[model samples]
Target: MKVNVDLRLKDIPGQLVAALEPISKYDGNIRGVVHHHDDRVGGRITVNVIFEVRSEQSLDKILSTWKEGEVDIAKIDAFFETYPIQYLLVGSITSKELESITKGLEAMENVASIEIRYTGTANSSSRAALVTGKASKKETLTTLESFFKQRADKHNYMLIRGLD
Candidate 1:
């Protein structure tokens, strides 16, 4: 079974390794990890780990070990499928508008994560953004593309989708 674990650990040296050791010990194979260093709640950092477990018992043991180590388990999700998407946005897009679009994308059921990169002066009327999102299905991707197209039309921007 593939599992996505969201954990919060104190911002101290070796905290990430300590939290991951239990997963290894319980025979959980790590697939990927996303550490949000820029995001901190109180004194803790949020980390998301994707791994595969052979049995339910192994997953339970890993959770138990996390509790014993004082790692805060924010969430645990069983993920079966996902798809990567990337696109570029051109023409007048402000930070506020970009945030609104990204928030809307994040609210979709199939969407997992959204990342954007933009570089433009405050006074510039023309700006560009590289938008990336992960969706669980092709239908979701179609929906997202439609949403982006509508948003760009409303804002008089150009939406260029990347080839997968």
Candidate 2:
């Protein structure tokens, strides 16, 4: 079975290896590991690890090993990537705030560009943010939403996620 395990870990060094080491021991073959740095969500570093393995038992063991030391499974899903994922952020967005959001994504690895639409107050939450990330479609979607959610909550914005 192919399982997608999403884990949130600390931003400090070596946490990535710590999370991956256990998976191999449990006969989990990593398909893709999307490691990202999220400034929001209490600044917890997030990783969307995609693995192909057999049996729920092996997955459970790996999960148990990683369920501590500030490591958490945000989601465990069965995922497949066709291509890249796209997101739209529509709300009252200031240029400066949007710039910060872009910078935050840039600070993480694989975030390519943030092309914003600048809708200019079409509604109560009527601004647009177009972000492109070099992450697996599912991981990119998850990571982007998590970041947007924190920024929106802090600054009162609404985000919508879908295909471009």
Candidate 3:
């Protein structure tokens, strides 16, 4: 599994190293690290670390160690191996409808992540939204297609598969 850990560390010497030690101690293979020194919130710097762990148990251990080390974890995002699918929605897309659709997709059991890109004036009835989602299984992909199709039909939108 790939995990992204968002950390806020105090602006003290060795604070960054202290925060990262727990990941290595718990055997998390470090993939990338984005240390943002310029961005600070209340004397703390934001650090985004991406790593891979063998199992859920390993992730738990690493998080526990972070707590023990007094590392402030802002957020954690996890990703599993997934198949990607894209859909283009055109015609009469309101922000509320798009939000509803995205939320609905995210709430599904097999969906891992969703990214939406909308293009058109807010006041225009004709709009386009490009949506991408990651699914873990073949059945889930079929379900996703059905879900989107239903939404498009209900909202009178033209649904286009794949992005040009």
Candidate 4:
């Protein structure tokens, strides 16, 4: 899992190194670190750290170590090998059909989240829906795109896919 964590550390020498040690100790591969040194508040600076860990347990260990050492964590977000997919569906789409499509995508395994935005004209049979989703793996997303393409073909709709 890829994790992004925002931590506020004391603006003192060695605090940065001290804050980073636990992540490496817990076997987290540090990807990037952004230190907001000029934006200190109450003698503390904010650091945004992005890292990949093998499992949730490793992440928990890192967090626990930080807490024990008095580190102030502001935020955390975890991603499971995320891949994005977007499609523009153009046809005579109805609300019920849209709901069914959304439900179908949500039912698939490894699909983290799915969203669709619909737009319709006042004087035409053509409608547009912007479908966006995030999956845990590239293969899962590819499978989803193929399924969507089949649906589009069966319904005689034009499917415009967004560049990966």
Top of the candidates by lDDT: 4
**Model 3 misplaced regions, further than 4 Å:** 82-164
Query: What's the lDDT of the predicted structure labeled candidate 2?
Result: 0.71
Against the true structure, what is each candidate's TM-score?
0.50, 0.45, 0.50, 0.56
RMSD of each: 12.6, 16.6, 9.7, 5.4
Off by over 4 Å in 2: 68-70, 79-164
lDDT of 1 by residue, 1-164 (tens): 78998899898899999999988999989999999988788889899999988777998899888888789988899755667878898888988888898788878887878798888964467888898867766678888888889899998888999785
Model 2 worst lDDT window (10 residues) = 78-87
* Cα lDDT of model 2 by residue, 1-164, tens digit: 68877787778889889989988999989989886765236777678888976667887788788865457778888643333545666677788887798788777554544455565654445667775444533445566667878988888877666654
**Tens-digit per-residue lDDT, 51-152, candidate 4:** 999888999999999999999998899987878878898987777668778888978898888888888852336999998978877778788888888888
Q: For model 3, what is the alpha-carbon lDDT of residue 105? A: 87
What digit string (tens of lDDT, one per residue) describes model 3 on residues 90-109? Answer: 99988889889878887898
Runs off by more than 4 Å, candidate 1: 1-79
Name every residue pair that clashes in candidate 4. none
Model 2 RMSD, rounded to 1 decimal? 16.6
Q: Pick the candidate with the highest TM-score.
A: 4
